[model samples]
Target: MSDMPATPLLDTVDTPADLRTLKPAELRQLADELRQETISAVGSTGGHLGSGLGVVELTVAIHYVFNTPDDKLVWDVGHQCYPHKILTGRRSRIRTLRQGGGLSGFTKRSESEYDPFGAAHSSTSISAALGFAIANKLSDKPGKGIAVIGDGSMSAGMAYEAMNNAEAAGNRLVVILNDNDMSIAPPVGGLSAYLARMVSSSEYLGLREFAKKTIRKLSKRAHNAAAKAEEYARGMATGGTLFEELGFYYVGPIDGHNLEHLIPVLENVRDSEHGPILVHVVTKKGKGYAPAEAAADKYHGVQKFDVITGAQDKAPPGPPSYQNVFGETLAKLAETDARIVAITAAMPSGTGVDKFAQKHPERAFDVGIAEQHAVTFAAGLAAQGMRPFCAIYSTFLQRAYDQVVHDVAIQNLPVRFAIDRAGLVGADGATHAGSFDVTYLATLPNFVVMAAADEAELAHMTYTAAEHDSGPIAVRYPRGNGTGVPLPAVPQKLEIGKGRVVREGKTVAILSLGTRLGEALKAADALEAKGLSTTVADLRFAKPLDEALIRRLLTTHEVAVSVEEGAIGGLGAHVLTLASDEGLIDAGLKLRTMRLPDTFQDQDSPQKQYDEAGLNAEHIVDTVLKALRWNEASATGGGARA
Candidate 1:
């Protein structure tokens, strides 16, 4: 409440309809108020700040000019949606963002009609926008599709893939290239801005559309020459060489912060009947806020912060984050292994590859927003005898699945996958959850999948993957700080297809995978209090599972339970298959599996998510208790335990 800014102008804006009422001149004040409100809201909630700050004017301009809901305004990645959210009647709940039972950090279609298509991942906006545009065209609906994509997102092949089919949408699709943080931020307020408005205005668009249709009718040779000439001419005139070559009517390099420039150009684009137009609007990543502007990353994502000083609230002092440990360990490992190389898809810092990059910049590759490329590039490196660790988030790895299967797993190439953010990532919810990586990767024939029980286990798995050059190996670890375990002086390579037993007991055995092992230990203590002997084993490898350990535990123990921080058909499913195949379960052994529920879990604390998923200690104890009773009844050949 204290951090909430006094947004008098912004208070007047309840929706895009309300925003549309104000005169064009009044929008500057409104944008300033919106910027302050956005900063205040994010400062209190601690979500995406810098990206929203950068798009204040652009958000104000888009909603003001276009008739939203009717006009599909799709935000690419949704990182900058805070400002848009505030303008679109979600301001009251703005500060509740990323909290338990709160608004999502990214755009969710269910949240509001304003969010036409849900987006958390980058580069899908243009494609979604085209879908909306074509659907509208077919339905004879009275609206167009507008996608606001950032420059960083332009690196993905999907954006170009959308642009290639843009002509078919015809005067219905509008893409606003939000070039906020490009390497070369376009020069502000010059002849380029004036020319952009002139070229993109309603009066000029009719002629431009006619020329586009006329060009399509040309011969291949004539079309190539004409297209090349048009590309260079537009590039010189409006700074859109690449987009023009991709069949988009390019217009911009306009200053996004300049509301006067932004509003008019957007108004022209909205009113025009020209299809598949891309307006490149250049803006700063963190504008207006002094501290954000000064920071290198413009406070892209942040913890709760002081609005005045922009000083973010720091977490309590604890062990280093799993990311930092991964980076440091990889850097250390690279010192001895010259064959080790690192690759990330536009997320060197997020994946902790930046640490390795600092030590071995020559060997590290930050393939920008191109996960498909990153996977294949790593596969190529592995094929040439170099060990390439494709450090990517588990959620992002979904984009390169085909490449992982065809290039790495199918070929049996030894490309190492250092998957960060392995399980229920807080705030980001199901969209960013790393729950399916085990099921997806482990199911592949030559793929070896592993999840870290803790920070120390993560190191051992890292060493193991580097040492083994057999096939594609993926080691998954969760987000946030580690469990402060003492690290070995040097990482050790463990025997594959083997699991270590944490505690030995005869009555009930709890088999654990990934971070769930800690909870399994807690459940063991609880089970012990009830006079039940529980053995806890950390099943480190999800694929090539420790079959001997599984058979031993199931045969010796009356009841066996498998726990994991993954969806169904993951570690537990694999264990069940092995147990059934081995015929060890024929002796009336009660078996149970614990995993995340079938439904998609929403945004909540990691602990709450695990609790809801029945992967926590209490659930584990409950599961074991139920299994124990069932085992007793089955063993006696008739009556219940009680």
Candidate 2:
């Protein structure tokens, strides 16, 4: 609390309505205070710091210019929304971000009315904002849909698709392209700022409209030539020919950090009569903060750090991260196998593909934010006799599911899918949680689904997937570091459908999948202490369903419980379906399945999330005990079966 920054101007404004009351000259101080408040808040909470720092002036300019709650403003990928959140009545709980039962790192529709649409995914803001614009246009309402998208997000085809259809929205759609990474034009200066303000001004637009009518009164070819010459002149000056071609009246390459330049341009765009408008505002990733400006990526997503010094809190050194383990293993394996290659959809370092790229830059490819293309590209490589591993986060992979099915599974291509973040992700909440990959991928035909219980198992599964040319094989792992198990020096190629029993017992059988194997073993220990002999089996493959191993465990044990860190339709559903098909459940078999609850979990610590979902050791013990009691009651005929 003592380290919190002084924000006198920010304290006077709670919402955009309050922000709109300030004079144009006072807004610069308000933006400065807002930036300080954002840095201080994120310093304690440790979330996206650099992106929010970059957008402080822009956030102030937008809220000061527009009626925000009424005029829907959608942020692409929502990482830079902390400053916006502070400006829009969430500063009190700003320090509670990414914690249990607190504010989310990304925007949520349920959180506030100011956030018109919730977004954590990339390239969806334009589409969502267009929907709002068209709906308002249809209802004859006085609201505009403003989409703030990044240049990196523009790499996806969806943004262009939305732009192509944006002509119908008329003047109600305003797209602010936040160009922080790629400098789309020459640096913003006095001339460029003046051009942006002049072009967006109503006087210039009115004169242009009159000229268009006058030219149309002559010949159609003359009108067309006049428009082309005018558009090309502006295109050469401001560098927005591409956006002009997409049916938007392109404006700017203005300074995003300069409130003097940004406010007037935004105010002009709001008052203009254009159907769809695109404003290109260039900014640095970390504009005001010196530490973040120096190293943008390191501070982009940060940990709790000192306010005076930007030194993030580091976790105690232990085993390597699961991603790094996979990357190193793949790189090592690729040395012997020339066909091995790697692909990632913009997240090279996040997915560990950067490690592979470092070893073999020619083979490793970062295809930007195009997951659909990544999957299909890997499929093509596989068809051409190259072992292409499409490494992507499980949440992002949902975008390319059609490609996974049509391009890979239907063709039976051997494209190896290295699914990262394959379980409940902490802090990022349900939006980034990889909760459905097992359920989704395991159900598909010609797909081999494997969940690694530890980093050692991940290495084996990685090698296994590399060697398997039979069909499309996938290996999924969690977000954090491995469970400290010693990685194999020489990785083994595991059998496709065989599961290994980690702990042996007779009375209770706990079938485990993914990283929840540790909890399953702990549950076995607790069950054994309670006079129950428990068996824990790490069922690696979720698809093929280790029928023989599962059948033996189900028949031999008094109670069989399936434990997996996935949704209802994953390992438990498969095992249940197999039991029903083989008539294993008809013989009074007491079967129980432990999985994540049927709800989207909020941001929390991983341990608390698992406990809240009732998938922890104590929950597993309770489930086994409850089932055993029901079995005993059914056998005695004293109580009815539960």
RMSD of 1: 2.8
Model 2, residue 462: what's the lDDT?
Answer: 98
Model 1: how far residue 296 lies from native, Å: 4.0
Local distance difference test scores for all models: 0.87, 0.92
lDDT of 1 at 30: 93
TM-score of 2: 0.98
**Using Cα atoms with residue i matched to residue i, what is each candidate's TM-score against the true structure?**
0.96, 0.98
Model 1 TM-score relative to the real fold: 0.96
The collision pairs in model 2 are 170-275, 171-275
Q: At residue 170, give the lDDT of candidate 2.
A: 89
Off by over 4 Å in 2: 630-642
Q: Per-residue alpha-carbon lDDT of model 1 for 225-246, expressed as tens digits?
A: 8767866987886677777777
